[model samples]
Structure formats: structure tokens, C-alpha cells
Target: RARSRGRRCSVTGTPLLLCCYLAYLALGTSVFQALESSAARDSKEGSKSDNWTSLLNYTCLDRQALDRLIRDIIQRYKSGVIFLSNTTSMGRWELAGSFFFSISTITTIGYGNLSPQTMGARLFCIFFALLGIPLNLVLLNRLGRLMLFWVQRWALWLGGAQKNQARARWYAGSFALFSGLLLFFLLPPILFSSMEGWSYEEGFYYSFITLSTVGFGDYVIGMDPGRRYPVWYKNLVSMWILFGMAWLALIINLVISLLESSIVLCPCSRRNPCRT
Candidate 1:
């Protein structure tokens, strides 16, 4: 992999890039099973009281919506499937269990366990989401592209045909638009409605509103004891929202690439010229 990676970079001596490559190679597959087991334990111990302390709580799910979330959590817990969490728990074992979970939540993979609870934390999340989201996407893209270049000896392998830099960018943008719709519009409603027992429209509306950071508190995550997940769940939801934002940034980049390509492909006007 190191030799393969070296051939991909045009630069002969950039140590930082090499370090990133090394990190990617090192961290790619650490502890999938452990994360799942720990999350399951947290779910089994979940409670009505813990909702407000979530790292990822939002105001859209309301009581009924929250109840549905709780059911899914409990169901998953009972089924003994592994989920993700980033919360610090009681013991050293539990604290250590949160190691990978914290990494995922902070980076926004948001397997859905640990999250923020207080208003101050949520407010901090808004800032963190904006800044951290782009960082994650850029890093993910670089890491992904590096891996592709290493293994395939090409920029893009199977996803699509490689084009000029501009065309490649446009292709990426299309992916962005598609993903954005799925994340911002489609997935939220499906997840919310299922968890909160909300109407699909209401779920979507809340998704849109909360994602936009409007925070119309007409509906909220923990208002219903019957519906809310444990504190861990809400915290994870916050992490998910941030991850959603990072995905959104990828979409934006894709859109910009597409527009740039379209302009390049078209005949030039007086105002804009295609640079050779």
C-alpha cells in the first residue's frame, strides 16, 4: 500500500501527505465489534430521564416522535445488535468502550450513541458542526482519493469514468446533489416518522427546519417520556446532525464542480472565457 500510494502523488517529498496515508492505513479497521457491543449495553440501560443530556438532541421529534425512537432503540437493544455511542459511561471499561464511539461521533459517522445534552452544548454544536463538517469531508475525500489512487492507479475506479479535472468535478457535484436530497430531505423524515410517530410531512418539515438551524421549538426530542431514547441516543442524534452537515458540504462541492464544468463545456460569452 505504501509503494502504491507513493506512485499516486505527483509530489516526491511531501511528508504530511505521506503521514495522512499512513494514518489511513493504520486506522482503517480498528474495532467494529467492540463498538457494537458497547452501544448495545448502553441501549439496554437506556432511560426516560437521560434524554435532555444528549449530544445530538433536536426539537423536531417531540414526545410522540421520541417514543418511536425509544422503541427502535429498545427493539435493537433486545435484538442484541451492535450500535454506536460516544458518551463517557460509569467504569473504565465503559469509558474505554466510548473511545471509538467518540471518534465516530466527533467525525460524524454518528452510528448513533453519544451526543450533547445542554443548551450550551447544543449551541456549541452549531459552531462545531459548521467548522468540523467541512474538515471531515475534506479529510474523508483526501483519504478516499488517496486510497483509490493507491489501489486502482487511477483517480476514479468503478464509480464513473474519469474525465478532465473539470468534468470529474461536475460528476462529483451530481453525487453531491443526490446525496443532499437523500440526507436533508428523504432520510430525516423516514427516520423521524418511524421514531417519533410523526407524520412524514411533519418529520420532513422538522428536518428541514432543524438542519437549517432555525430551531422552532414547537417540537423537541425529549418532551415525551414514552418516545425519547436514553441520553446516549440524543447525544448520538446531535452527532448525526453534524455528520449530515458534512455530507451536505460534499454535495455543495459537487454542485459547484458541475456548474464549473457546464460553463466550460458551453460556448464562451464575452464575459466568460474557457481558459486553455
Candidate 2:
């Protein structure tokens, strides 16, 4: 047989990864669509079939009966015992929610403030995560390595033509760290502040929390009531978050590589791995 061009799985991984992702995308879209559709139907059904409507229409009911009916309905509405929506407001599992949930799951940020309330969605979330997390890890690791290669070349070039190698390397590390912060942190907050109508501080906090994957579950995007945004707006926000996570991975990988190199170069490293 002719010599193989590369590793046995080199050709296989790309197609396998593509297939896995497509399957997840198709399956997840179908499942979440179904779940959200059912929820919408239920909410509409409740709104259509509210008990108060019959009570208000019935002529035979006395004042006491009407008062009791109003009291019960008011209590239900206040306690979240009923969920009603007008034409403008979408249900919890509408398109925006579906997009948000998908991003949150893959990122493992799990912003606890919003989740699928239905059993089908809960079960799906569990298994989908089981399968998707590995795919995420592998892809992120590969991307991190690719980014690290470029970062090292840039750093080496920047720090070159120096008399002291160690000082040059240190300078390079500092450059990478500063650039990563500026790219991943400082710039995005400005756009976010304007788009989300948040103050600069809140925008920065949200950006930092999201990229770090801390996901305290406090702040989220596109929550403005009675405001209509274009379809591309929310979709773009989701894409931005995913891109930021990839960039964050690159930063972490760069830092780790720098640390390892520093340890190797340290005068004491030849004697002990942990000793300073």
C-alpha cells in the first residue's frame, strides 16, 4: 500500500467533527423547536381558556360570586399561576430563548436565571450536554493550539534582536497578556454598553463575567421590554459571545505555554520541577 499522507485519523477527524456538529445542530433545533412550540401552545391555551372570561360573561352570578371569582383570578395571576401573553411578547421558549439556551449549554455557563421548565427539555439538556461538552473541549483545544502558534511567532519576533534572551521573552509575554486584555475586554464593552443600554461599568462586568465563564447568571442581553430588535441583533450577540470564548481560550493557552517555558529557563528548574 502507498504510504499514508498523515496520521490515520487526520483525514477522519475533520469530517467526523463536521458530522457530529451538524447532527447536534439539526437534532437540537428540532427538539428545542418542539419544546418551545408546545410551551407556546400551552400558554395560548391558558390565555384563551382563562376562568375569569367565563365568570365575567355569566349573567347569573351574584356580586359575592363575582368578587370571589375576581379574588381567585387575581391571586393566580399574582402568584404566577397563570401565564398570558399579548401579540408582542413572546413566550419563554421563543426564538431568542432557543438561541440563548444553545449558546449557554455549549459554553457551560448555565446562567441559572433561565432554563427549560419542561421535562423533555430537561432530559434533552442533560444528554445534549453529555455529547456536546466533549466536542466543545476538543474544538477549543485545537483552536487554542492554532492561536498559540501565531501568538508565539509574533512574540518571538517582537522580542528578537535583544542581548538578553530572558528579558526579551518576558517582554514578549507581557505584550501578549496586554494585547489579549485589550482585544477581549476593553473593546467589546464599548459596543455592549451602547447596544444593551447598560452603563460602561455594567457592560465591562458582563463582558468579563461572560468571557471568564464565571457566568454569575445576573446580567444578560436583549432583555428590554416593549422594544423590538431585528433578527440579526440577537444572533450577532450569540456569535460575539462564542468568538469571545475562543479568544479567551487562546489567552489561557498562551499564558500556560509562557509559564512552562519560564520554568524550563529558570536556573533552579534543572534541579527540581517545583523548586523556585
Candidate 3:
């Protein structure tokens, strides 16, 4: 009975976590839009030479020191020691909303809607992913199992038969295959073909190229000339890519666990060793 209750808690917790993430994304979008507008207003009112874009010059610090600092910050975020603290006064609830942003970026979601604006920040991100990628994989593996276990528990709690870990692993695999198909075959063509005026094959290829983080930028979304929708539409596309990548990593982890559990040794080889 206790196990059943625990399962229910886990199932409920997953969506609650996702909801909290979406709320954070919304807050970030608002804050960034406000900041950009304020900067634009300031630029227009000030002297022509005093452009807001010029404020980005890293003259105060030499290039070498700036590079070192960026590397340090990247490492800190990767180790989970640093978090993104919002500068604007959006209150504590909004500040908490930024945590989802931190988690996604550190995991290399690279939503592109929100990104490191400064050269230092971008350089740090380069090295941050170098160290964080493997560590992220390790954490993902553990989380996948925990997620599946909870899902199984929730099912049993609802009076369904509990699926064995092996069976759960298979289901996860099947879901991953389905996700890949939708992503690599269906979604890109349907969404991008009309916008890019490319064939369905080209659209499908573009989807894989983006989700894989190749970022060739040759066929990036919203790069199409005169594409409609405000900045918010671009942000949504970025979030979708991030979510898809997260799901891909989870599925890969499940496949690994399944393979690990399926090892076997022949009984004849063990019992007739003396005959050899």
C-alpha cells in the first residue's frame, strides 16, 4: 500500500515539475522583452555615439583575463554551484522561475531565446559543455530509471499489474523510437516546408540537423526571409527543441539499462568445464 502511494506521488511530481518549468520560461520571456525595450528607448534618447550596443565592449578587462573568468563561470554552472539570478524586480516567485532556465542551459538546452549575450558568457558556455556533457549523461541515466520506476508504481497504485523493470525498459525504448520517427520524419516537414519552401525531404533533414545541435545555421528556423510572428514564436520553437533533446537523452539511457540487464551465460559451458 505504501509503495502504491509512493508511485502516485512520483507520477504527480513529474508534471508538476514540467509546469514549474513552463512558468519560468514565460517569466524569462517577459523580463527579456522589457529589458530590450528599455535599452532601445535609452539608445534613441542618448547621443548617436553612445549606442547601447557599444556598452558591450570588454575594454575594462583584457581578453586573457576575460576568457579565464568565463571558463570559471561555465565550470561553476556545470558543477551546479552557480545559478541564474534575475536582475529585474519580478519578486521571489519569478526568481524561482529562473531555476528552470539554469537547469536547461547547464544541460546544454541552448534554447537561443535566452542566451549568454556577452563574449565572456559565450566563451564560458563553450568550455562548460565540454565538461558538463558527460556528467549530464550520468545524471540522465539515473533520472530515467527513477522516472520509469515511479511510473510503474503509479500504474500499480491504480490497480494495474506492475510492469517489471525489463518490460518498462522496452516500453521506454518503443517510445523513443516513436519520438525519433516523429522528429526525424514527420514534424520538420510539416512545420518547416511551407516556411522554407523546401521539399519534405529537406524539412526532415533540417529537423535532425537542429536537434543534433549542429547549428550549421544554414537552415535555421526563423531564418527564412520575412517569417511571420513576433519574438515569442521563436522562443516557443527553441523550447520545443530543448524538450525534444531531453526526451532523446532519456530514451538512450533506458536502452543502456535494458542492455545491461539482458546478459546471459550458457549452462552447458559452466557445467561441462571439466570436459574441456
For candidate 3, give the lDDT: 0.55
lDDT of 1 at 51: 54
State the lDDT of candidate 2 residue by residue for 1-276, as single tens digits: 112422333343446556767988999999999989999988878866785466667757766787787788877654434345542222245666676776678788776545766689889999988988788778777766766677777667766766566777777767766776787678777877777677888888998888777888778776565456567767676766766777787767668667544533332323343321
Task: Write candidate 1's Cα lDDT for 72-185 as tens digits.
Answer: 988865443536443124111244334533444446544333344458856876787678767766775665455334434332542356546566655655555575678667
Error of 3 at 65 (Å): 41
Q: Pick the candidate with the highest TM-score.
A: 2
Tens digit of per-residue lDDT, candidate 3, span 13-69? 556556767888999999999989889877777834453334437356655665687
- TM-score per prediction, in order, is 0.36, 0.56, 0.39
- Poorest stretch of ten by lDDT in candidate 1: 84-93
Which candidate comes out best when scored by lDDT?
2
Off by over 4 Å in 1: 1-155, 159-172, 228-232, 249-276
Clashes of 1: 25
The candidates, ranked best first by TM-score, are: 2, 3, 1
- Model 2: what TM-score? 0.56
